[model samples]
Target: MLDQLIENATVVDGTGAPAYAADVGIRDGRIAALVRRAPGAPADRAPDRAPDRAPGDAPRDRARTYVDGTGLVLAPGFVDPHTHYDAQLFWDPYATPSMQHGVTTVAGGNCGFTLAPLHPERPGDADYTRRMMARVEGMSLVALEEGAPWSWHSFGDYLDALEGRTAVNAGFMVGHCALRRYVMGPDAIGGRPGADQLDAMLRLFHEAMEAGAWGLSTTQSGTHADGDGQPVASRHAGPEELLALSRAVGEHQGTQIEAIVAGCLDRFSDDEIDLLVRMSAAAGRPLNWNVLTIDAAVPERVPRQLAPSERARQAGGRVVALTMPILTPMNMSLGTFCALNLIPGWGDVLGLPVPERIARLRDADVRAQLLRRAGSEEAGVFRRLAHFDRYVIGDTYAPANEGLTGRVVRDIAAERGMEPFACLVDICANDDLRTVLWPMPSDNDPASWELRRETWQHEDVLLGGSDAGAHLDRMCGAPYTTRFLGDCLRRRKLVGLEQAVRMLTDDPARLLGLRERGRIAEGWHADLVLFDPERIDAGSAVLVHDLPGDSPRLDSRAEGVVGVWVNGVRTVREDALTGAVPGTVLRSGRDTETVGTR
Candidate 1:
């Protein structure tokens, strides 16, 4: 007899075969038997895709629990391969917004900026390896300040901090920022690590891998800035230091690498590509890097760039797994940083207090001065890509710009007879800096949206980088899976359902070597999500202040996550929390072994 059975459901087995009606049986946290209906003539009126009825089988009694999933879909549980829950784990164990969706497994430590192994007693600790996640990843400094206790100081100690109990299963990549700070002190922050410091960092990497860290990650994207608007640690490191770290990760068995290389696109010459290829050959293991987004500018032309380091794998480089995000909902506040990535010199304005930012924006001299400082050559590129549309209000003293809630910045600028930048400043100052903005894509076109589906189907591309626990205010990539399903799979049918599910589940799981998770098979961990196929939709994103320091973050509730079980415990039953904490801090290459329910 099965421990539990779901009768009359569509089984879109994680493998991209075909979806069919079937009855699935579960026992001991695994799919015990695929109870197929007999051949032809509707044996017992069950679907033909249901496991073929055994010959001369005894009439069995009902399962311990019965789920009449007549119109539901059951596939492998979703695995979020990229997030920054390193600090958020302590306060919200369940990983909240993510686990509430179908995500059963999470991999944190993307972009190389994680909080762990810090030596706060050291002089450079506050500067080099710091907790201004708000600046880099949009994490709240208040949460980092008031919520986290400086308990552990090594990679292993950080793992220990996550051990015994956690909300959902997670694997971590040893952070580059923490490692550099641990080894090099302030020199690394200013520029590159010295030879001796590089060696120390390598040693630390080895220790972290041995301590069950999944891998290592570093970011070279210009977007990842310090609180003072400088590049983070790994961004400035010379190639030699990065090559050394790659070698260290290669030496450790069960390790991978993730790096963000936005500047690489601008700076890479042929020699640089050759060097990247060399690094890959040295690393041996696959590298997962911050990825390819759906670019609207040139459509699918892709700027003639070779990115996602894994693309270099065929040319004898490291397999930098592409961390693809299907959506880019540009979440921005009305401060100087509103769509700052789009607007050059805007992030600096955002870093200021509201009054100061407003003052700077109101000063025409400052604008003209900064524009002159930008110079013609560099300023041209900024103007082309920066769209004045899609800026909305996220917060305010009260709702001041309620009338202009979703209006584009261009419209506001035109109506107010001001430069787009000046209009943005006025909106921020007049509205108490509460306006938020996002890019509203016109439609899922074949070139962009279709490319997203095709890229995920790419055998080398790794489906991850939701930035789930980070990006508090503006973005909510956590719902990337649901959006992918609702838009690409269901709405447009760009990709089949089974293939899409596998991209979210087995792909990342297999990449991380998660043994028993991400599958619905016998003897596997019971991390499951049951949902209605037709009724599924990712609700729109909204802000909530549920964090330790009352930090506001975008969260989306899953529409069709009917049930979710973690390690045989129904952590989420009927789309609500059962509060059964059956998650563990999964080790690299050993992402199994369920932790006890807390």
Candidate 2:
């Protein structure tokens, strides 16, 4: 008897193959057979024999469950190659929004930040780590303080804690920051490790791989900082130390390296590209990186960024760029630290208590300084805050400002005969800092969207970078899966459904080395998604108070996901979680095979 049967579906198969009408059979947590129907056959009627089954065997009626997948697309569940769900897995095992978007597998511990391998002697380290995440990852301090158990101290211990507590297959990469902090203590923040310290770090890295970590993740981006606004530990690493760590990944089977090189925020220098190639050469395995977005304003940006991977491949190394398929929307407010902090000297005041912050906002001298900085290049890449017209009031608490909601700051400022910055300050003050605002997305232009479609077809690029669990309060990256499906199937129609499914499934699966997954082939693990192509998309992000600490974060729900199965168990039906935690914790060599260039 079969465990389940999905009948009458147009199977996209996750192999970039043409659509076919088939009935998929599942049993014992794996795909047992794919029974394709002949032309003009009845939906419920089966052929003489099932594909990949014995010649005499027949499709049986003892199946426990059956799904009528008529007019729906069946493809392998998505594998997210980049995320920061490391801590959230402890609190929300399914990695919500992501799981709801048909993601069956996720890789966390991105940007060189993880929650393990703590130094035994460092007391109060957990709090410091929590604060660092709060600052760098946009995680709420209260949630991190209340949600994570912080029980284990080693990489293996961390994995053990998550053993059976997930509904989506999860894996983590050992973080360079945690490794440095463990071995070098206070010096990890700003100083390079000496030879002895490097050896210790390498040993720990090797230990983590042996304990089932997928690989190593690190960052050298200028934007990342600890809670106190200091550069992260990975930024201090010299090229030698980084190459040694990459070499450790090569020594271990089924492991690759993930790094955020310089120029992630803007453009990469030739030296930076060379360093990335060297790291990949040291690993002798694929090196994947987070976030390559197209700025249509600059027509050459996409080609210039892709050129680095070409250079790396010529050097006997491989580098795959991860690009998101959607225009990310971020909802922000002054009550929280956000893009507003990019205004020069604003961080000092934003970090202060509410009373002091309110006083500082009312000060003319401070306001002038802020306006100058916001308009200057010193504001870094986030200088867009100077365009106050792009900000629209979202929600407010004060009655006096009730009518201002959804109004742009520039219009309000003009009517009041005040500068945009001063006008914004006055409004927030009247509301006691409880007004929420939505900034106009700079990348939401049509040119940018078309460029992303162009970039999607690039040979060295992979679709990923959904920073799901991180940036919880400010951004929701978890919905990129469904959002991209809408782009491919409904909106832009740049790629056909089969190619898009292949990009989301087989592409990342091959990079992560997940064998027998990421496809709808018989004998593969039954991680599948049944969704209507027309209705599939990430719905609008809305604030939800579902976190453990009553902390609010933007979350999106899937529109057309009919059902999702993990290891042949229905974990989601009709876009709702089924409370079935049938996921496996993937280990480096034991559970994964080698991933390479397609």
lDDT of 1 by residue, 1-598 (tens): 6666666567776767677766666776666666554433232323333343421221253456656666678777789878888778888888878887788888888788777777757844643344447777777778776766657777788888878567588888887877876776665667676667777778878888888887778876666777756677777777888788877766665677777666332333455456556666667766665554444443532333344344465655555445455655656564535334434565566567877876876899876755553434444333432444434434444454557765777787888888876776677677766655564554345566656655555556667778788777778888777777776446777767787788778777776768877766656776777887776667888888887768777888888778776665567766688776778888865653311101
- Give candidate 1 regions above 4 Å deviation: 1-3, 38-63, 120-130, 191-195, 264-272, 299-303, 307-311, 321-325, 334-343, 348-353, 363-385, 389-402, 409-421, 441-446, 592-598
lDDT, candidates in the order shown:
0.67, 0.84
Question: Which candidate tops TM-score?
Answer: 2
Error of 1 at 445 (Å): 4.7
Name model 2 segments beyond 4 Å from true. Answer: 45-61, 343-349, 352-380
For candidate 1, what's the RMSD? 5.3
RMSD in order of candidates: 5.3, 3.3
What TM value does model 1 have? 0.86
Candidate 2 lDDT over 449-546, as tens digits, reads: 77888788877899988888988867888888888889887788878889999999998998889979999998999999999987999888888998
